[model samples]
Structures are given as structure tokens and as C-alpha cells.
Target: MKQIFTLGTLAAACIIACAPAVADTATQPTASAGATSAASTSESRKLNKLADEYWDALARFDPVSAGESGDNRYADQIGMSIAPKNRAHQFALYRDYLKRLHTIRRDGLAQRDQTSYDILDYELTTALRFEPFPEHLLPLNQMDALPVTLANYSSGQQAQPLATVKDYRAYLNRLTQLGPWIDQAIANMREGMKTGVVQPKAVMVAALPQFKQLVAAKAEDSIYYTPVKNFPSGFSDADKKKLAAAYRSTIAGRLNPALKRLADFVEHDYLPACRTSTGWSALPHGMDWYLARVASQTTTDLQPEQIHQIGLKEVARIQGEYARIGPKMGYNGPASGLPTWVSEQAKYKPFKTEGEIIDVYRKLNAQLQTKLPALFSLRPKTPLDLRLEPELSRATASDHYTPPAADGSRPGVFWSVVNDPTEYGSTGMVTLFLHEGQPGHHFHIALMQELGLPDFRKFGGNNAFTEGWALYAETLGTEMGLYDKPEDWFGHLNDEMLRAVRLVVDTGMHAKGWTREQSIQYMRETLGYTEAAARNATERYMAWPAQALGYKIGALKIQELRARAEKELGPKFSLPKFHEIVLGEGTLPLALLEKKVDRWIAESK
Candidate 1:
């Protein structure tokens, strides 16, 4: 699943954190002896204001990000997220902020204020490192393409508002901006081809169907036409007629043509020239580029070889766990063979309808609610909605969580793809819900929004922390009394195995020069992934480097911290309070998180 930005394209990818427009209900922490003076208080306020200004400028520059942030001020605006000019502008913005941030003396700031400084500093520098790579050229993919994002937002199910005539007009404005953006994207890809920076042929091939699906012969059949069809209650008949006609004109005359052109270019022009090689190291300055991505995603100085070795160890451990569980589940198959056996079991694939699949998840959610308070002292106030992945996005989508609207207009949603009901298994339901719903992303993200943290703290996030926290949350499924059955417990290991396998295959393909076929084979043999599943996973790592590394790296760090906390605090250790501390300040880099928890440990002692 794609992280934070709903518009999962290149332009929106670099935005690691942003704040939702939530009321400031969270009180500031008390100042320590080092930070209690009036001067320190004034300095903290100055930093807060500076951070606000910084994020406000950022939200205005990228309308897609603003839309994701629940800031409707730029709702009518849509710009090319990865256009060269825009990239240059964003780079300059980061540089300017970094220079200004340097001018603010960091000494004697409150603990939380210091955290904001460090996170902002790290994010700014990390963003700058991305400037050297040709990310704009490889803008769209099957998992995070513009077509899927547009279809999702326009379906009246995402962050874009469609509640009033003004909201409808704003959406129309965004549609108008698509033609130029699409042209720019095509141009960037063409330039990339000349520079040996083209996307993998498989990715481009997979994206063709999505583009075709997005365009329709009739404007009324387009996903963009949905808002017009389902107009709000207050519009007068005249206004409805006028807006409906305008939407039809925009979708047919402007939007559909753009989609068709892009699809034709990808199928006829781009695909023929697309690179057959899967590794980023195949491109010019590819090794450096891959390393940059590794550092950015993991937010660490880890080498690929190091990460690969870690993955190897993790894979072996999870395999041992899987082996033990297989026999307990009445399967005599080897541990390496358990996933295939369970995937094919009739008892696991019991659902007959899509509604049944969704209902089963809802029941899982209900069961977890009664158990959440025991593990979490603080929970997100935002309501959680369980949904089926939208029809247009399901083919490319996985079961994932989408954050609540910053304005709380819509609740956070955990969507599972139900492409074929009978084939959808229930073995992973509890852990999936735990990871995507409460005590996972929903808890970490929504609580940040609800707490009224700075916009950067509220919206800005690193993958290691965000995804790691979710992976760690999956381990708590048993604590919640959800994974009692051996098959159910095995599903948790299967998922963990997937993350560990990612470490190996992602590093193998990118740094070790392993071919796509080799990576796929490794995944199937070691993780029990079917050939099709293995190929998809391999392609995903190929598309986004080092991203898969974050789950294991982050989860390991969190688990390590929790273990340390439990050991040091001894009888004083409180699971709920430790959870509160971990999530209390929102998403942080692994190092910052360690420091925060260490301070808490010291204070507890």
C-alpha cells in the first residue's frame, strides 16, 4: 500500500509530514529546568510560528499535498508535482528553510520544541538529497499512478470535498489542470528515456490498463462525472443543470482526451523504449541514486549489504516460527511450504460474497474495540471506517489505511481489496485490521491530527516510523485475543516473512545485481509466495527502492525500545503509558524516537 499522500505519484511522494487542520486540544508539555525560563518560552513560540509559516508555504505550493492535508484553501489548485520547474522551486524552498532554521538558536528549547527542530531539519535535508535523482521521469506506477489517484478522489470517497457548489467548482478547477500536468509528465518520461532513466517495462505495461479504464466514451461514464451525478441537497435546479453540463464538458472534452493520450503514448511509444532492467543501479549514477533512496526511506546510514544480512536473519527466524505453527495447524508440510498450503485451504477461504468479507472485518473491528483500552491509554478520536477498495483502485491496491480528513470531514478508512470473494482468505484479517486500523496507522496518524500538533508534526511522516509502528502493532493481535488459531497465528508470520523477504530481494536486486527472476524465485522458495505474488512483490521493490526496508528496520527498533523500557522500568513499566509515549509526539525518525523513549525511561526510573 502507498504511504501518507493519497495521490501516490512522484510529486506527492517526497512530502513525509504535514499537519491536519485540527483544533489545538493538546496541551504543551511542561518545561524542564533547562527550558523553564521566559526567554526559552519565547524562543519556543518563535520556532512554532516559524514552523507554521514553513508548512503553510509548503501546502500552498503543492495543491495535491494540501488536499491530502485537509487544507481546502488550495482545493481548486492542481499543479504538476514533479515538473522540473516545480522540482527546482521545491528544492529552493527547502534550502531557504534550512538556512533560516540555522539562524534559530536551538539551545534551551523545550524538549518537544527540540524534537520539532530535529525532525524538520532531517526532513529538509532528506528532501534535498532526492533532488539529484530523476524521480520525476518515473512519476507514475501501477501502485501509485495518477489515474488511480484521480479515480479515487473523484469517486466522492477521498479527501477532495464535494459537499457544496463551491466544492464542486473547486474539483472542476482541479480537472482543468490535468491536461497540462499530463503533457508535462509525458515530456519528463521522454527526457528520462534519453538519460537512461526510464521506468521498468513491467511497470509501464501494468499501468496501461488503468489509463484505459480511466477514460470513457461517454463523459457520464467517467469517474469524474460522479460528483456531478451525486450533487449535494442545497443546489437549485438551475445550478445543478449548469454544473452538470460543465462537468460533462470537462470530463469528455478535457480529461478523457488527456488520459487517452497518456495511455497511447505508454503503450505505443514509452513501453518499446522502457528499460528491461529492474535495478535503479542500471541508470546513470544509479548506485548513488539507489543509496540516496535507501537513506531517504530508512532515514538511516545503513548499507544495502547490512540491510540484506538483517533480512536474511529475520527470514530464518520467521521461517522457524512458521514451521512450528504448521504442524500445530494439522499440516505436515515443511515450514517453507506452509503459506502455499494455507492459501489453498478451503476452510481459510470460506467467504462466498464481498459483503461477507467486509462484514467479517467489521466484526473483527468490534472485537478489537473492547480490547484496545487495555493496550492504549490514548486512542485517536477520529472514527474508523472499514471499506472495500474502490472498484477502480482494487486491481492495483492492497489492503491499506487511508487517513481521516484533516478537517474531520471524513473518517479514516481501512480498505481491503475484495476482487473475488471466494478467493479472499480470512487468516490475516485480525492482524490486517490491527495494522491498518486502531493501534496502528489510524492510531498514530489520527491521534497526531487530533492532538493539534504543528502542521509538520501532524502531516509530516517518515516511512520507517509510520510503517514500522504498524508492523509492530500487528504483533499485538495476540494480546488482543484475536489470533488464537494456528492458521490465524501463521498469517502473522507470513506477513512478517513478507517484510523480511523484502529486505533480501530489494537489496539483492538493487545492490547485489540479482535479476528480477532471481529475486522472484528467492521470494517463492523462502517466503512461500506464489509465483504471481512473488513477481508483484519483486516489481514493487524495483519500482520503489528501500521502501520495503522500513517495515523490518522500524519494527525492530520499536520492539527493541519496548523491550528496553520493560527491562529498565521493571515493575514501573506500563504498556499503555509506553504506547502513549511512543505515539504521543506523532511520527518521528527512529533515532528521535529512541531519544524520546530513553528520556521517558530515565524519568520513570
Candidate 2:
């Protein structure tokens, strides 16, 4: 999972869905005296000031997101974002910004400023559309919830810093608020039961162990005790003792009991009320909600049926490639048999220890560095580091990338989850590294942060662009000569197939009334995944609807643009320049990206 903090989505359409309003506002007549160049300059200045103010207000509004991006001013605060009063205030803030934004004349601004205006408008409009939906009712899930985020912070290895005495005290202050947050979360879940917006029963069952793991009998045994055990070497014994005592008291008095209460609430009160139906359509007004998710996630107006058809076509196409390669690997079996044959081979599972797994990725990083300059004129200055996933998150987590801090305090890290070395497959290693490590997320995200763009573009993302870029990066493996072996190529296709499978399964469950078991069985037959792998994949989609649709949708769009550039430009084309154009601006919605690429092609001619 690539960690992206996406803004909300528009209802049932692309960003262009809101363009008529912008167009109307832009064309309104201006007063004759106020229509001079001075007026244009004033509007531009006002827009710039608004951008700055919005970023600052957002930092205070969602401090965790700000802290992750390397803003430390609000490190001690965790606002009650889900509470009704706070939610209302946040919506009012968006409405105010949007109202002020419309007063600026978009037609009079510079091209760059015009782009920023459109992006900000899209974000505000999309966010406001979600006001009718009650996302606050379900605050936590088996994956990517507040608890998982907080636990990652406690390790002292994530975005939260523990480098000084002040840093330690700030964290303690943050923990003091956890009890209330948990209580509110439980209260919200209870409200959800009445409103018919609850999570699936299986997801709640899966989340129980996560809460249980955090309820330790003693503070010293808690995961939050991590910082206390590894104090900075410069700390005097007196300071260390005092900080440790404070941590122990906070964890025992505030954190542990809160965690236990949450665990008990889920087990006793919430489980019986969870919805057994797997898809979003089962809830109130769910079909509309799922449609909104589709538009927002893919940044397109693609309907569920349209996306499902596209997935089917892509799956068939990839399966043909698999059949073509299967003969060369000395296996004349059917394309569906390829995954099993590859997995059963002892040669692919050679690692006896975790160290060997890390070594394999390090070597891939070294090999990739020498090949990057040939294809990319724009590369990130931020370094990419490899680390194993922490023990607590490893069970539920996949291999993922975390972006570097804005202040350069931390480097981007690719966490490889090595649960059991002997069971880890090696063929996927090359493509996995390509997708999560180097020229994939690290290159795109780190470079975006490094660019001199608006704060929203730097920190905000569209899932289609982010995941699509990573999936497209996997295809670059072939051009880079990383997939020299038949097995390696098979791994690439298999991973692609998983994304394709997601298109079928995600919509099937959420829009077409597919059961969890039905989805799991379809994955096993198509990708040759074991029952456990298939189940995990199904549950992930169940937890996050329409998110999986972005990978293949975004990748195909990029590939389409590249092919168009190649055919039109012929000998005049430069791969590096084309890449620069696609990635030069920070992340864009798919429609905006198409317009940008088309403009670049026209200019080059």
C-alpha cells in the first residue's frame, strides 16, 4: 500500500463535473474601472494569500497529516476531527474557502496560477459533495485506521520524532488525548448501528486482534514503551528516569485502559450489529456512494459497468502474454497453471533468513540506480531507504513506501514485510521493488515534495495518479532489462493480473452483488493465489471500496498517453522529456493529465 492522504471525491463525475460553475463565475461582467491590469494583479495576490492561509489552517485542522509531512508545530495536538461540532466547523471552512475562491477571476491569472486555481476548486467542490455521507461513523478498520497510524508513530521510527526531550514530551502530550478519541470512536460506531453505516462483520472480526494486542497488563510491556527503552544517548540519567516515569504513567493510566475499552466494545457491542453484506450497495443510498467513490478514486466519469468491462479485457490480454511466456520457462501448462508451477519451484524460495530477503532488495536498488539516468531527466533528490515492516503491522500490512519528511529529517522508506522467510517468494521481488521502491513511488512522491508547487499538490494526492504511476513503473522493468528471465516476466504479469482482478472483484462485490467467498474463489482461479492470499485480497477490497480500481485505470491512461506521444512524435520524441511532462507537475486528476499531455504533444510539433 502506498501511503497517500487523498482529499474527498466529487459525486458521480470528474473534476470537470464542477467546471460549469467555474466557467459561469469566470465569464461574469466586471466593473469597467476595476477591470484593469491592477485588478488582475490584486486577484492574483489574493489567490496566493488564500493558498497560504488554507495550508496553514489545514495543518492545524489535521495535525497528524501535517506532522507526517514534517510540520512539527502541531505535534502535540490531535483534534477531535470526527466529532459533529468539529466536522461542521471543517465543512464551514471549506465552504468559506470555495466562496472566496470563486471571487478571483480565473481567466486573468497566469497559466501556472490558473492550474492551481482549478486544483483548489476541484478539492473544495469534491470535499463538499461528501458532506451528505457519514464517513465519521466508521473511524477504524482492519487496515489504514487511526490506531495503526498511532502505533506506527510509537515505534520512534515513523514520522513522529523522538530525537530530543521536547520531542518525547510532545508525544506524551499526544497520547494523553487518546482516551477521549477512543471513546468518541466507540460512540460513533454505536451511532453507525442506528444509521445503517456499519462495517462488514468480517472486517470487525479481523480488527479485534489489533485492538487486543495493544491492551497490555503493564505499561512496560506495551508497544508505546518503545521510546522509553531507546532514549537518546545524550539524555542525562535524571532526564531519562523522569521521562520514562511519565511515559509509564501515561500508558498505564490513559493509553492501556482506553485500548482495552475499545477492544471490549468491538467484541461485545459492535460485532453483533455489523453488516453481513459485503458491498456498499447494502447500506442506505449505497449505490450512489459507490458511484461517487468510483469517480473520485479514478478521477474519471467511468461507470462501474464500464470499469468492469475494461478489467475483463485487460485480464484477457495479460493472460495471453502469460501463455506466450509459459512455453519458454519449460512449462507447457495452461496460463492458469503458471502461478502454481512457479510457486512450487524450490528455486524461487531460496531465502533461509530475513537478512537474505533484505539483501535481495538492496542488490536490486544498486542495479536499478545505474539504469535510471537513461530514462528519467527528472529524479528525486530525496534518498530511498529499505527496512523490514515492524512486527506489529507486518501481519496485516503489505510492502509499502512512506514519503520523506518535508524538512529532510527522514528519508523515504520501502518497508518489506518478511513474515516467514522460507515462505517468501523471490520472483516478485524485482517488480515489487520497481513498484514500491525506486522509479515507482519514491521517484514520483519524493520529486513532487521537492517541487516548488502549492502545498496541496505537495501533500495531497489523487489515488488514480499515484497508484497508476507505480503500476506503470513495474512495466519499466522490461525496458530496464530487470525482467530478463521468464519467471521474472511472469511475476510482472501476475502482479498486473492482480490489479486486473481487483477491477473485476471490487465492482463485483460493491456494485454487482458478489459475495466475499465468490470474490475469493474468482481470484484463486484467475491468479492461482492460495486460499489465504485470495481471502486477504478480498477483505482488503471489502474494507476499502473502489480503491483497487485506480491501479489499472491510471496505468492504462499513462500507457495510452505514451503510445500517442510515440506515434505522433515519431523520431522527434524523447522518453525522458515525455516522462518530465507527465510527472513535472505534481499529481493531477486523470482528465487534467490528459489535457496536459495533449498540450505538450501539440507544442512539440
**Candidate with maximal TM-score:** 2
RMSD value for candidate 1: 4.0
TM-score (C-alpha, index-matched) for candidate 1: 0.93
| Candidate 1, lDDT over the whole model | 0.79
lDDT of 1 by residue, 490-562 (tens): 8888889889999999999999999999999998898677889888888878877777888888899999999
lDDT of each: 0.79, 0.82
User: TM per model?
Assistant: 0.93, 0.94
- lDDT score, residue 13, model 1? 32
Which lDDT value does model 2 have at 194? 96
Backbone N/Cα/C clashes per model: 8, 0
